[model samples]
Target: PQLGGPIWADPIHDIEFVQKVLSAVSTNPSRFGTSKRIEGMLSMMTEELPDVPLYYALDHLCSTVHCNTPAMLQFRSALLHAGYRVSMSHASRNGLKTDAPPGVIWDLLRCWEKANPVKRERLSETSPAFRILSTEPTLQACFDVREDANPQSRKRHLVRFQENPQANWGPKARAKDSGGISSELEDKRKLCQNKRKNQVTDASQLKNFPCKRFRKGTCTHGDKCCYSHESASDEADKME
Candidate 1:
Protein backbone atom coordinates (compact mmCIF):
# COMPACT_ATOMS: atom_id res chain seq x y z
CA PRO A 1 0.00 0.00 0.00
CA GLN A 2 2.98 2.36 0.79
CA LEU A 3 5.03 3.84 -2.15
CA GLY A 4 8.18 5.88 -1.14
CA GLY A 5 9.46 3.59 1.65
CA PRO A 6 8.30 0.89 4.12
CA ILE A 7 5.50 1.95 6.50
CA TRP A 8 4.44 0.30 9.76
CA ALA A 9 0.70 -0.70 9.85
CA ASP A 10 0.64 -1.59 13.58
CA PRO A 11 1.96 0.40 16.58
CA ILE A 12 5.06 -0.77 18.44
CA HIS A 13 5.64 -0.50 22.23
CA ASP A 14 8.59 1.62 23.48
CA ILE A 15 10.71 -1.34 24.60
CA GLU A 16 9.88 -3.33 21.48
CA PHE A 17 10.79 -0.33 19.28
CA VAL A 18 14.12 0.04 21.11
CA GLN A 19 14.87 -3.67 20.58
CA LYS A 20 13.95 -3.40 16.88
CA VAL A 21 16.28 -0.38 16.46
CA LEU A 22 19.10 -2.20 18.21
CA SER A 23 18.63 -5.30 16.08
CA ALA A 24 18.51 -3.24 12.84
CA VAL A 25 21.63 -1.23 13.72
CA SER A 26 23.52 -4.38 14.80
CA THR A 27 22.60 -6.43 11.72
CA ASN A 28 23.17 -3.62 9.19
CA PRO A 29 26.36 -2.02 10.50
CA SER A 30 27.67 -1.01 7.04
CA ARG A 31 24.42 0.82 6.17
CA PHE A 32 24.83 3.12 9.26
CA GLY A 33 28.43 4.45 9.03
CA THR A 34 32.12 3.55 9.63
CA SER A 35 32.99 0.96 12.35
CA LYS A 36 33.69 3.65 15.00
CA ARG A 37 30.51 5.62 14.17
CA ILE A 38 28.35 2.47 14.32
CA GLU A 39 29.99 1.46 17.62
CA GLY A 40 29.19 4.88 19.15
CA MET A 41 25.56 4.69 17.97
CA LEU A 42 25.16 1.17 19.42
CA SER A 43 26.69 2.25 22.78
CA MET A 44 24.42 5.33 23.05
CA MET A 45 21.31 3.28 22.15
CA THR A 46 22.26 0.42 24.56
CA GLU A 47 22.41 2.86 27.50
CA GLU A 48 18.67 3.62 27.02
CA LEU A 49 17.65 0.07 28.02
CA PRO A 50 16.21 -0.40 31.52
CA ASP A 51 18.58 -1.68 34.18
CA VAL A 52 17.97 -5.15 35.67
CA PRO A 53 16.72 -5.07 39.27
CA LEU A 54 19.07 -6.32 41.99
CA TYR A 55 18.56 -9.86 43.33
CA TYR A 56 18.79 -8.84 46.99
CA ALA A 57 17.01 -5.66 48.14
CA LEU A 58 18.93 -3.07 50.18
CA ASP A 59 17.27 -0.83 52.82
CA HIS A 60 18.67 2.71 52.79
CA LEU A 61 19.64 3.90 56.31
CA CYS A 62 20.03 7.67 56.48
CA SER A 63 20.88 8.41 60.13
CA THR A 64 19.20 11.40 61.82
CA VAL A 65 22.01 11.64 64.40
CA HIS A 66 25.41 13.04 63.46
CA CYS A 67 27.99 10.25 62.95
CA ASN A 68 31.68 10.79 62.18
CA THR A 69 33.80 8.29 60.22
CA PRO A 70 34.80 6.34 63.35
CA ALA A 71 31.16 6.22 64.50
CA MET A 72 30.05 4.96 61.07
CA LEU A 73 32.81 2.31 61.15
CA GLN A 74 31.65 1.26 64.63
CA PHE A 75 28.03 1.04 63.38
CA ARG A 76 29.12 -1.14 60.43
CA SER A 77 31.13 -3.37 62.79
CA ALA A 78 28.10 -3.77 65.07
CA LEU A 79 25.88 -4.68 62.10
CA LEU A 80 28.43 -7.25 60.89
CA HIS A 81 28.62 -8.70 64.42
CA ALA A 82 24.82 -9.03 64.41
CA GLY A 83 25.10 -11.25 61.25
CA TYR A 84 23.63 -8.63 58.86
CA ARG A 85 25.16 -7.48 55.57
CA VAL A 86 26.01 -3.75 55.46
CA SER A 87 27.60 -1.36 52.97
CA MET A 88 28.02 2.39 52.41
CA SER A 89 25.29 3.83 50.17
CA HIS A 90 26.09 6.08 47.20
CA ALA A 91 22.91 8.06 48.04
CA SER A 92 24.69 9.70 50.99
CA ARG A 93 28.30 9.69 52.29
CA ASN A 94 27.12 9.17 55.91
CA GLY A 95 24.22 6.85 54.92
CA LEU A 96 24.47 3.03 54.81
CA LYS A 97 22.50 0.32 52.97
CA THR A 98 21.81 -2.74 55.12
CA ASP A 99 19.56 -5.81 55.37
CA ALA A 100 19.24 -5.34 59.18
CA PRO A 101 15.75 -4.58 60.59
CA PRO A 102 14.75 -1.26 62.27
CA GLY A 103 14.86 -2.83 65.75
CA VAL A 104 18.40 -4.18 65.17
CA ILE A 105 19.59 -0.77 63.91
CA TRP A 106 18.08 1.05 66.95
CA ASP A 107 19.63 -1.54 69.29
CA LEU A 108 23.04 -0.99 67.66
CA LEU A 109 22.71 2.81 68.10
CA ARG A 110 21.83 2.31 71.80
CA CYS A 111 24.91 0.08 72.21
CA TRP A 112 27.14 2.76 70.58
CA GLU A 113 25.70 5.43 72.94
CA LYS A 114 26.37 3.18 75.99
CA ALA A 115 29.97 2.61 74.84
CA ASN A 116 30.65 6.32 73.99
CA PRO A 117 28.34 7.91 76.66
CA VAL A 118 26.51 11.02 75.35
CA LYS A 119 25.95 13.84 77.90
CA ARG A 120 22.44 13.52 79.41
CA GLU A 121 21.92 17.33 79.44
CA ARG A 122 22.40 17.61 75.66
CA LEU A 123 19.60 15.15 74.77
CA SER A 124 16.02 16.45 75.21
CA GLU A 125 13.33 14.10 76.65
CA THR A 126 11.31 14.49 73.38
CA SER A 127 14.35 13.78 71.12
CA PRO A 128 14.48 10.50 69.11
CA ALA A 129 17.94 9.76 70.56
CA PHE A 130 16.57 10.00 74.14
CA ARG A 131 13.55 7.79 73.33
CA ILE A 132 15.73 5.18 71.56
CA LEU A 133 18.51 5.22 74.23
CA SER A 134 16.02 4.86 77.12
CA THR A 135 15.05 1.37 75.92
CA GLU A 136 17.52 -1.46 76.67
CA PRO A 137 19.09 -3.17 73.57
CA THR A 138 17.37 -6.43 72.61
CA LEU A 139 20.54 -7.75 70.90
CA GLN A 140 24.11 -7.69 72.20
CA ALA A 141 25.80 -5.10 69.93
CA CYS A 142 29.62 -5.07 69.90
CA PHE A 143 31.46 -1.90 68.86
CA ASP A 144 34.79 -3.65 68.24
CA VAL A 145 36.11 -3.31 64.65
CA ARG A 146 35.46 -6.55 62.73
CA GLU A 147 37.79 -7.69 59.92
CA ASP A 148 34.91 -7.50 57.43
CA ALA A 149 33.74 -4.02 58.54
CA ASN A 150 36.12 -2.28 56.11
CA PRO A 151 34.54 -2.58 52.65
CA GLN A 152 36.36 -3.83 49.53
CA SER A 153 35.84 -0.45 47.79
CA ARG A 154 37.96 1.32 50.47
CA LYS A 155 40.62 -1.42 50.42
CA ARG A 156 40.87 -1.23 46.61
CA HIS A 157 41.10 2.61 46.76
CA LEU A 158 38.48 2.83 44.00
CA VAL A 159 37.23 6.24 42.85
CA ARG A 160 33.75 5.74 44.33
CA PHE A 161 33.13 9.36 45.43
CA GLN A 162 34.05 12.21 43.13
CA GLU A 163 35.59 15.37 44.62
CA ASN A 164 34.35 18.73 43.27
CA PRO A 165 36.32 19.50 40.07
CA GLN A 166 36.19 23.22 40.91
CA ALA A 167 34.66 25.47 43.56
CA ASN A 168 30.99 26.49 42.95
CA TRP A 169 30.66 23.63 40.41
CA GLY A 170 27.01 22.75 41.01
CA PRO A 171 23.84 24.00 39.19
CA LYS A 172 23.75 27.74 38.66
CA ALA A 173 20.93 30.22 38.05
CA ARG A 174 20.05 30.75 34.39
CA ALA A 175 22.37 33.15 32.58
CA LYS A 176 21.38 36.82 32.47
CA ASP A 177 19.67 38.40 29.41
CA SER A 178 23.20 39.47 28.33
CA GLY A 179 24.04 35.72 27.89
CA GLY A 180 26.80 35.77 30.54
CA ILE A 181 27.08 34.70 34.20
CA SER A 182 26.31 37.28 36.92
CA SER A 183 29.21 39.49 38.12
CA GLU A 184 28.91 38.27 41.74
CA LEU A 185 29.04 34.59 40.77
CA GLU A 186 31.94 35.19 38.34
CA ASP A 187 33.94 37.08 41.03
CA LYS A 188 33.33 34.27 43.56
CA ARG A 189 34.47 31.64 41.01
CA LYS A 190 37.67 33.62 40.27
CA LEU A 191 38.45 33.91 44.02
CA CYS A 192 37.98 30.13 44.63
CA GLN A 193 39.95 29.00 41.59
CA ASN A 194 43.43 27.56 42.43
CA LYS A 195 42.57 27.92 46.16
CA ARG A 196 44.04 24.50 47.05
CA LYS A 197 47.10 25.05 44.83
CA ASN A 198 47.89 28.34 46.62
CA GLN A 199 47.39 26.80 50.12
CA VAL A 200 50.36 24.34 49.85
CA THR A 201 53.20 25.69 47.66
CA ASP A 202 56.08 23.76 49.22
CA ALA A 203 56.31 19.93 49.01
CA SER A 204 57.63 19.82 52.61
CA GLN A 205 54.24 21.10 53.89
CA LEU A 206 52.69 17.67 53.04
CA LYS A 207 55.34 15.61 54.81
CA ASN A 208 55.32 14.23 58.42
CA PHE A 209 51.55 13.50 58.23
CA PRO A 210 51.07 9.91 59.49
CA CYS A 211 49.42 7.60 56.94
CA LYS A 212 46.50 5.76 58.59
CA ARG A 213 46.77 2.81 56.15
CA PHE A 214 50.53 2.55 56.75
CA ARG A 215 49.96 2.60 60.53
CA LYS A 216 47.39 -0.20 60.07
CA GLY A 217 49.98 -2.03 57.85
CA THR A 218 47.56 -2.10 54.89
CA CYS A 219 49.16 0.62 52.71
CA THR A 220 50.11 -0.78 49.29
CA HIS A 221 52.14 2.29 48.27
CA GLY A 222 55.55 1.57 49.81
CA ASP A 223 58.59 3.92 50.27
CA LYS A 224 57.45 6.14 47.40
CA CYS A 225 54.41 7.22 49.45
CA CYS A 226 54.24 10.92 50.36
CA TYR A 227 52.74 10.24 53.84
CA SER A 228 55.09 9.21 56.69
CA HIS A 229 55.09 5.50 57.62
CA GLU A 230 56.91 6.12 60.97
CA SER A 231 55.13 5.72 64.33
CA ALA A 232 53.78 8.71 66.31
CA SER A 233 56.71 8.59 68.75
CA ASP A 234 59.16 8.45 65.83
CA GLU A 235 57.48 11.50 64.27
CA ALA A 236 57.71 13.32 67.63
CA ASP A 237 61.42 12.40 67.86
CA LYS A 238 61.93 13.72 64.29
CA MET A 239 60.25 16.99 65.34
CA GLU A 240 62.77 17.34 68.17
Candidate 2:
Protein backbone atom coordinates (compact mmCIF):
# COMPACT_ATOMS: atom_id res chain seq x y z
CA PRO A 1 0.00 0.00 0.00
CA GLN A 2 1.08 3.59 -0.64
CA LEU A 3 1.53 4.78 2.92
CA GLY A 4 1.53 8.56 2.56
CA GLY A 5 3.05 10.72 5.29
CA PRO A 6 4.61 14.14 5.80
CA ILE A 7 7.38 14.80 3.26
CA TRP A 8 10.75 14.42 4.91
CA ALA A 9 13.14 17.31 4.44
CA ASP A 10 16.06 14.95 3.91
CA PRO A 11 14.75 12.53 1.29
CA ILE A 12 18.06 10.64 1.11
CA HIS A 13 17.78 9.52 4.72
CA ASP A 14 14.02 8.97 4.45
CA ILE A 15 14.54 6.54 1.55
CA GLU A 16 16.87 4.52 3.77
CA PHE A 17 14.23 4.44 6.48
CA VAL A 18 11.55 3.12 4.08
CA GLN A 19 13.89 0.40 2.79
CA LYS A 20 14.57 -0.71 6.34
CA VAL A 21 10.82 -0.88 7.03
CA LEU A 22 10.18 -3.03 3.97
CA SER A 23 13.08 -5.36 4.75
CA ALA A 24 11.69 -5.81 8.25
CA VAL A 25 8.29 -6.65 6.80
CA SER A 26 9.76 -9.10 4.28
CA THR A 27 11.96 -11.14 6.61
CA ASN A 28 9.86 -11.05 9.76
CA PRO A 29 6.51 -11.36 8.04
CA SER A 30 4.95 -13.31 10.87
CA ARG A 31 6.09 -10.75 13.45
CA PHE A 32 5.29 -7.62 11.42
CA GLY A 33 2.93 -7.95 8.39
CA THR A 34 1.74 -11.18 6.83
CA SER A 35 3.78 -12.54 3.86
CA LYS A 36 0.80 -14.09 2.03
CA ARG A 37 0.15 -11.00 -0.16
CA ILE A 38 3.53 -9.15 0.15
CA GLU A 39 4.84 -10.15 -3.30
CA GLY A 40 2.07 -8.29 -5.12
CA MET A 41 2.52 -5.27 -2.84
CA LEU A 42 6.25 -5.12 -3.60
CA SER A 43 5.64 -5.51 -7.35
CA MET A 44 3.09 -2.71 -7.42
CA MET A 45 5.28 -0.42 -5.34
CA THR A 46 8.27 -0.95 -7.64
CA GLU A 47 6.24 -0.32 -10.80
CA GLU A 48 4.66 2.96 -9.71
CA LEU A 49 7.49 5.20 -8.47
CA PRO A 50 5.92 8.59 -7.73
CA ASP A 51 9.09 10.51 -6.86
CA VAL A 52 12.71 10.32 -8.05
CA PRO A 53 15.89 12.36 -8.41
CA LEU A 54 16.27 13.87 -11.91
CA TYR A 55 19.60 15.68 -12.28
CA TYR A 56 22.29 14.80 -9.76
CA ALA A 57 25.68 16.53 -9.97
CA LEU A 58 28.90 14.58 -9.64
CA ASP A 59 32.60 15.40 -10.01
CA HIS A 60 33.65 14.36 -13.52
CA LEU A 61 37.01 12.66 -13.02
CA CYS A 62 39.42 13.04 -15.94
CA SER A 63 41.83 10.17 -15.41
CA THR A 64 44.07 11.05 -18.39
CA VAL A 65 44.97 13.85 -20.84
CA HIS A 66 44.60 11.73 -23.99
CA CYS A 67 40.91 12.68 -24.17
CA ASN A 68 39.74 15.85 -25.99
CA THR A 69 39.23 19.16 -24.18
CA PRO A 70 36.22 20.39 -26.19
CA ALA A 71 33.98 17.87 -24.45
CA MET A 72 35.10 19.26 -21.08
CA LEU A 73 34.52 22.82 -22.32
CA GLN A 74 30.97 21.98 -23.40
CA PHE A 75 30.38 20.37 -20.01
CA ARG A 76 31.65 23.52 -18.30
CA SER A 77 29.24 25.73 -20.30
CA ALA A 78 26.33 23.41 -19.51
CA LEU A 79 27.17 23.46 -15.82
CA LEU A 80 27.52 27.25 -15.94
CA HIS A 81 23.94 27.49 -17.22
CA ALA A 82 22.94 25.10 -14.42
CA GLY A 83 24.88 27.30 -11.92
CA TYR A 84 28.39 25.88 -11.54
CA ARG A 85 31.80 27.52 -12.09
CA VAL A 86 34.63 25.30 -13.41
CA SER A 87 38.40 25.46 -13.78
CA MET A 88 39.50 25.49 -17.41
CA SER A 89 42.51 23.56 -18.71
CA HIS A 90 43.52 22.06 -22.08
CA ALA A 91 45.54 18.91 -22.88
CA SER A 92 48.41 18.38 -25.44
CA ARG A 93 48.85 15.14 -27.31
CA ASN A 94 52.15 15.61 -29.25
CA GLY A 95 54.53 14.97 -26.31
CA LEU A 96 51.99 12.97 -24.31
CA LYS A 97 53.11 9.46 -23.41
CA THR A 98 50.91 6.57 -24.40
CA ASP A 99 50.15 6.54 -20.67
CA ALA A 100 49.94 9.79 -18.66
CA PRO A 101 51.92 9.75 -15.40
CA PRO A 102 49.78 9.53 -12.29
CA GLY A 103 49.19 12.44 -9.82
CA VAL A 104 49.30 15.74 -11.80
CA ILE A 105 47.16 18.44 -13.51
CA TRP A 106 50.07 19.79 -15.59
CA ASP A 107 50.15 16.54 -17.51
CA LEU A 108 46.68 17.31 -18.84
CA LEU A 109 47.42 21.03 -19.26
CA ARG A 110 50.67 20.42 -21.20
CA CYS A 111 48.82 18.25 -23.71
CA TRP A 112 46.23 20.94 -24.40
CA GLU A 113 48.93 23.62 -24.42
CA LYS A 114 50.66 21.89 -27.32
CA ALA A 115 47.43 21.55 -29.28
CA ASN A 116 46.31 25.18 -28.84
CA PRO A 117 49.32 27.46 -28.31
CA VAL A 118 47.22 30.51 -29.23
CA LYS A 119 44.65 29.66 -26.62
CA ARG A 120 47.41 29.32 -24.02
CA GLU A 121 48.52 32.91 -24.69
CA ARG A 122 44.94 34.14 -24.46
CA LEU A 123 44.63 32.36 -21.11
CA SER A 124 47.82 34.06 -19.86
CA GLU A 125 46.77 37.59 -20.89
CA THR A 126 45.63 40.24 -18.36
CA SER A 127 42.06 39.42 -19.39
CA PRO A 128 42.43 35.64 -19.44
CA ALA A 129 39.85 33.67 -21.44
CA PHE A 130 40.07 30.94 -18.77
CA ARG A 131 38.59 32.50 -15.66
CA ILE A 132 36.73 32.05 -12.40
CA LEU A 133 33.33 32.97 -13.84
CA SER A 134 30.08 33.54 -11.94
CA THR A 135 26.79 35.34 -12.56
CA GLU A 136 25.36 36.86 -9.41
CA PRO A 137 21.57 36.84 -8.89
CA THR A 138 21.50 40.47 -7.82
CA LEU A 139 18.05 42.05 -7.62
CA GLN A 140 19.24 45.61 -8.29
CA ALA A 141 22.09 45.52 -10.77
CA CYS A 142 24.62 48.38 -10.87
CA PHE A 143 24.99 48.15 -14.63
CA ASP A 144 22.98 46.65 -17.48
CA VAL A 145 24.33 46.10 -21.00
CA ARG A 146 22.32 46.03 -24.24
CA GLU A 147 21.87 42.66 -25.96
CA ASP A 148 24.05 43.85 -28.88
CA ALA A 149 26.46 45.92 -26.75
CA ASN A 150 29.56 43.92 -27.76
CA PRO A 151 28.43 43.85 -31.45
CA GLN A 152 30.18 40.47 -31.66
CA SER A 153 28.25 37.26 -31.40
CA ARG A 154 30.40 34.76 -29.52
CA LYS A 155 30.38 31.00 -30.05
CA ARG A 156 29.62 28.71 -27.02
CA HIS A 157 32.86 26.63 -27.26
CA LEU A 158 35.05 29.74 -26.64
CA VAL A 159 35.25 29.42 -22.82
CA ARG A 160 37.07 26.31 -21.52
CA PHE A 161 37.92 26.24 -17.83
CA GLN A 162 35.56 28.37 -15.75
CA GLU A 163 36.33 27.01 -12.29
CA ASN A 164 33.44 26.34 -9.92
CA PRO A 165 33.09 29.29 -7.51
CA GLN A 166 31.91 27.33 -4.45
CA ALA A 167 34.72 24.79 -4.76
CA ASN A 168 37.51 26.20 -2.59
CA TRP A 169 39.63 23.06 -2.28
CA GLY A 170 39.64 22.39 -6.03
CA PRO A 171 38.96 18.95 -7.54
CA LYS A 172 39.44 17.06 -4.28
CA ALA A 173 36.96 19.24 -2.42
CA ARG A 174 34.40 19.15 -5.23
CA ALA A 175 34.63 15.36 -5.53
CA LYS A 176 34.09 14.92 -1.81
CA ASP A 177 31.11 17.30 -1.71
CA SER A 178 28.80 15.97 -4.45
CA GLY A 179 26.18 13.37 -3.46
CA GLY A 180 22.86 11.93 -4.76
CA ILE A 181 19.72 10.32 -3.37
CA SER A 182 15.93 9.89 -3.60
CA SER A 183 13.86 9.89 -0.40
CA GLU A 184 11.75 6.88 -1.22
CA LEU A 185 14.76 4.69 -2.06
CA GLU A 186 16.60 5.76 1.07
CA ASP A 187 13.65 5.02 3.36
CA LYS A 188 13.34 1.58 1.82
CA ARG A 189 17.04 0.85 2.44
CA LYS A 190 16.73 1.57 6.16
CA LEU A 191 13.73 -0.75 6.41
CA CYS A 192 15.85 -3.49 4.85
CA GLN A 193 18.84 -3.01 7.17
CA ASN A 194 16.76 -3.20 10.33
CA LYS A 195 15.06 -6.34 9.03
CA ARG A 196 18.40 -8.04 8.41
CA LYS A 197 19.74 -7.23 11.86
CA ASN A 198 16.66 -8.56 13.71
CA GLN A 199 16.17 -11.55 11.43
CA VAL A 200 15.66 -14.91 13.23
CA THR A 201 18.73 -17.09 12.73
CA ASP A 202 18.64 -20.71 11.58
CA ALA A 203 19.34 -21.99 15.09
CA SER A 204 16.15 -20.31 16.37
CA GLN A 205 14.29 -20.37 13.03
CA LEU A 206 12.67 -23.84 13.54
CA LYS A 207 11.59 -23.08 17.10
CA ASN A 208 7.92 -22.19 17.61
CA PHE A 209 8.31 -18.68 19.03
CA PRO A 210 5.97 -16.27 20.72
CA CYS A 211 5.58 -12.64 19.57
CA LYS A 212 9.23 -11.44 19.47
CA ARG A 213 8.67 -8.06 21.13
CA PHE A 214 6.53 -8.84 24.21
CA ARG A 215 8.29 -11.34 26.50
CA LYS A 216 5.16 -13.28 27.56
CA GLY A 217 2.93 -10.46 26.18
CA THR A 218 4.74 -7.76 28.17
CA CYS A 219 7.47 -5.53 26.71
CA THR A 220 10.31 -4.72 29.10
CA HIS A 221 10.82 -1.18 27.79
CA GLY A 222 7.08 -0.39 27.61
CA ASP A 223 6.65 2.75 25.43
CA LYS A 224 10.36 2.96 24.50
CA CYS A 225 10.55 -0.46 22.88
CA CYS A 226 10.92 -0.36 19.08
CA TYR A 227 9.28 -3.79 18.67
CA SER A 228 6.48 -3.30 21.19
CA HIS A 229 3.35 -4.85 19.60
CA GLU A 230 0.97 -2.73 21.70
CA SER A 231 2.58 0.42 20.39
CA ALA A 232 2.55 -0.94 16.80
CA SER A 233 -1.16 -1.70 17.09
CA ASP A 234 -1.81 1.80 18.37
CA GLU A 235 0.27 3.20 15.47
CA ALA A 236 -1.64 1.16 12.88
CA ASP A 237 -4.98 2.28 14.36
CA LYS A 238 -3.86 5.91 14.29
CA MET A 239 -2.74 5.61 10.65
CA GLU A 240 -6.03 4.02 9.60
Q: Pick the candidate with the highest lDDT.
A: 1
Candidate 1 structure, TM-score to reference: 0.42
Model 1, span 1-240: residue lDDT tens: 124545443322255565677567668867755533443433333332133211111122223332222456777888888998776643345656566777887777666667667676787889765677789999888879887777654564544455577887787755677789764577557767887885756667566577899889999988877777888888788789
For 17-75, candidate 2 gives per-residue lDDT tens digits of: 54566576667778734452443333223322124211112122221222234343333
Model 2: runs farther than 4 Å from truth? 1-14, 52-240
Model 2: residue 226 alpha-carbon error in angstroms = 76
lDDT of 1: 0.61
Query: Model 2 misses residue 140 by how many Å?
Result: 50
